[model samples]
Target: MGWSLSLLPPPEPELLDAVFLSAGRALHLANAFENKCQYVLRIANLASAFDEDPALTLDEAIAAAPSDKMLGQTLHLLVDRFQTPVPEEAVGLLNKARAARNFIAHEGASLGSSYIWVARADTLIRHAVALRAAVQALSLGDCIVSRWVSEIEEPNVPAPRSWDDDYPPMVDTWVFGHFNGLLEG
Candidate 1:
């Protein structure tokens, strides 16, 4: 059977606002995630170079680092070349985040038609939220790798502050709670 847009009520302004906000946030988060991946890759390369040559200065190690690569290739190098031990759950999340980032960058405009044609703003919002979560997970893994590198570089220094050190208690709890549910289920 065919349907008509006239049969449905106009989209609520509040819902449209939510959809745009969520999608924008997802895009920004995806950008941050990619940057974090690049950083992790760079640091991992530096650490590996230093491991191979103890006498290499920091500048020399940085100079010896591999050239920049795409996100997928960087991740592969991190695992296969640098031997970073990413947990399976984090690897799954990282892959999903990469796909979500690609979709947002390349095909997100297709979702705009659904906003009016099918009045499916909720679907758009859900997609954005999932993208945000996946990117967040990937960024968290980046943080873990960052800490590992920091420790390797400065083993005598005291443990550094956590990423969430400034977050309010409720927000911290909520964020970790969501991840716990995602991880356990």
Candidate 2:
């Protein structure tokens, strides 16, 4: 005869809260990284296509690049098609981040159930924190690439609006500081 197992107790509210917070941050950072990749690819495409088709507008150029591709494919295009020079370290970080993002997207919920059932809330939180770190590092690399793109296209691009003008004081400060820190490194 097979033995029956009792259901485990629910996870602590605080542990659940931590997991949610970290998971949210990881997902947010992953999205931001994807956006940066799209921007880089679109701008690079514009730079090349504009000379050949003077009538091409930014919107047209952006539309020309496929947006449905996965992150790995997007990275490959940036390097191979656009000849964007990503540093070796940045490439490693991007790969790591991509893996983390994919895992969280595809299996996080399923794995989370197991962790919760086993009362491994700390492990779940740690996993989320690691994913967030990887994505955050990837974002820094994206920022560097963005800076490079801006420098190359400085003459064509207009001045950016001040952060303070668009965001509340607290948000503006945090935004400014976060970007400044990323760019500085």
Candidate 3:
């Protein structure tokens, strides 16, 4: 028989909000990388084809390149094709981003009924920073795709309107301070 883990309880609302936002941001980064990967591969392929035969068209090059792959596969192709060092850490961060996105979009209600991911706000912040690092690592000095990267601003980590005076509670001061330091650093 297969073993399984049981669910517990939902996390605090603020914690949930923070995770959802961070994961959503990471997902945005993931989408940008995915789109840029395809764009880069097509451009490179077209350039090479042009070098070989000037008759090749952009559409032909784009259709010829194997662009119908998943994001992870595209990242792998980047390494082999461009010799870029997308570290394993970066890949892990992307995967984390994807998982977080899936959880927020698909399993959000379920998350409210379980405690499997009772992570603190700082954890999400760290993940955001890691995603940025991954993007930085993948970018090239003079590549068109590098220029296609969608810039992400720092986390605002606050409600657009307002929260109650007791928001986040004074108990979370250490966490807020530590995460703020990570962002500043």
Candidate 4:
């Protein structure tokens, strides 16, 4: 089972916007990570199915690569349908941004305080954007495959699959797990 944010009421516009933006970025990165996982998994599946066959050239191999939209859809399905909590680092950043957003939304203060909030908000946004770009870079299927080949060594290899492959691909569980991870449980 997973936790539900829907039970809560809507937050103030300014603060809510910031929180939503942070959430969006977190999701974006999480999706990227998942896509990379799938890319490698599918490639392995292909290789495993066609063992010792070097018939396809690099160009032919790329032609057989998954489409960009397919990759995006896979990530989207993993994130939206599965709802895995994002990594701790991403959630921590989101929490910081969300707290700032909450202060912005609930607290009615002067320009000085607002300016401070805005500064923090901008920083959070910048960090989120950078994270998103790095995630997007992983969309290059080659990079994803290369990472798996390089990182997971033989004899005790971690299977190259998305987190969802470990658990049932349910969105609520992912969200709950991610939130729990953020809270350090």
Candidate 5:
């Protein structure tokens, strides 16, 4: 499809800044987009899971998460419920995008790089472009997620506040800073 400015909401300043930081600092050019999009997918799945099984909790979702791309697929499946259709091509694009991002973050090299043989970065970038288009198709209003979070009755999964207190404050400064940017209002 042709690039259409009319189809997208104006980029939010903070969102743009986060995306830039993802590229410049995180060195994951598609990091912000992937993270935000993943959350969007999660919101959708939660809605569906709740609709089908109201008792379903985040732990249930995590439990159901497949070790494969199903973890990612679960998120995208959420959009399908809102009658917002994403092309298979776009889904493929996002896969490569995240894969490339994983490589850069973990291995610091693309598939063709001598370091480790994996998928090509070019293939990943192509998917990134397609994912951008899909994300643009989602209105900001659609992007907003409001869900009920309750105290865990089970002594399982980590607590929400643990993010702030569990780790050595100094050691997690960089991690918290990166994610905190993504969580900013």
Candidate 6:
């Protein structure tokens, strides 16, 4: 909001460099928070596995992860678990945070000559803030029950309903890093 792309004068190099620096720091913090979340999930899942096989050690239980990218799948599992009280908005927010971090870190992304950096930094900073709070607030110790997972195996929907149907029809929301007709205000 502090800068506008359509303005005649492009932002100074100093400003761009500063935003870039902040972006890098935000990426690092967000990555660390994600690692912590993943570690917690690994232990939570190991607890579940141990419930079924008493002979299993934590190491043996953790070895059961079938894929290298466990955090993405584990977050989905935690969010979908009906017995846990994961916030409904948590899934989307976490997804946006991961996407923001990946785009900034992996796409050889750079601050554009205009206000694009403002938009990118805004997204990165907001998402990083959310991740930090989530990590601090997460309590995996209270959410390691396996009985609910086994008991609720069937889809008991009364009627076919899309998940998006629950959302409001429209709202003022900005998707970071995605620019169509909109520009940061």
Q: lDDT tens string, model 5, 1-185?
A: 23322344433434333333433433433355455555556555555666777787879966654333343564455445565675565555556545544544543322223211222334434433333333322212112221111111233643455433332233223322544633323
Best of the two (1, 2) by TM-score: 2
lDDT of 4 by residue, 1-185 (tens): 13333444433445435434445544543454544556655554445334535786656666665455444344343333223554555434333433333333333122232232233544434443443333333223223333454544442766555632322223223322333333222
Order of candidates by lDDT, top first? 1, 2, 3, 6, 5, 4
Using TM-score as the measure, the top candidate is 2
> By TM-score, is 1 or 6 better?
1
RMSD of each: 7.0, 8.1, 11.9, 15.3, 15.8, 12.2
Which stretches of model 1 miss by more than 4 angstroms?
1-11, 81-84, 108-185
After superposition, the stretches of candidate 6 with alpha carbons farther than 4 Å from their true spots are: 1-11, 107-109, 112-185
User: What lDDT score is found at residue 114 in candidate 1?
Assistant: 60
lDDT of each: 0.59, 0.55, 0.45, 0.40, 0.40, 0.43
Q: What pairs collide in candidate 1?
A: none
Worst 10 residues of 1 by lDDT: 166-175
- Per-residue error for 85 in candidate 4, Å, reads 24
Per-candidate TM-scores read 0.59, 0.60, 0.44, 0.29, 0.32, 0.47
- Model 6: colliding residue pairs: none
- Candidate 1 lDDT over 1-185, as tens digits, reads 15434556546545444445545554665566677677777877887898999999999998999899998887677666546566787677567657766765555434544634455656655554554454455455445454555666678984557553432233323433333333322
Query: On residues 104-169, what C-alpha lDDT tens digit does candidate 3 reach at each position?
Result: 334332333334346455554554455334333323211223332321122344333222222223
Off by over 4 Å in 4: 1-11, 49-52, 59-185
Per-residue lDDT for 63-147 in model 6, tens only?
Answer: 8744434556656765653346756565555665455445545431343342543445454444434433332222121122221
Clashes of each: 0, 0, 0, 8, 1, 0
Backbone clashes counted, model 1: 0
In terms of lDDT, the best-performing candidate is: 1
The deviation in Å at residue 158 for candidate 1 is 9.4
Q: Report the Cα lDDT for candidate 3.
A: 0.45
| Model 2: how far residue 131 lies from native, Å | 3.2
Worst 10 residues of 4 by lDDT: 108-117
Per residue, candidate 2 scores C-alpha lDDT tens digits across 30-49 of: 56667777677666666777
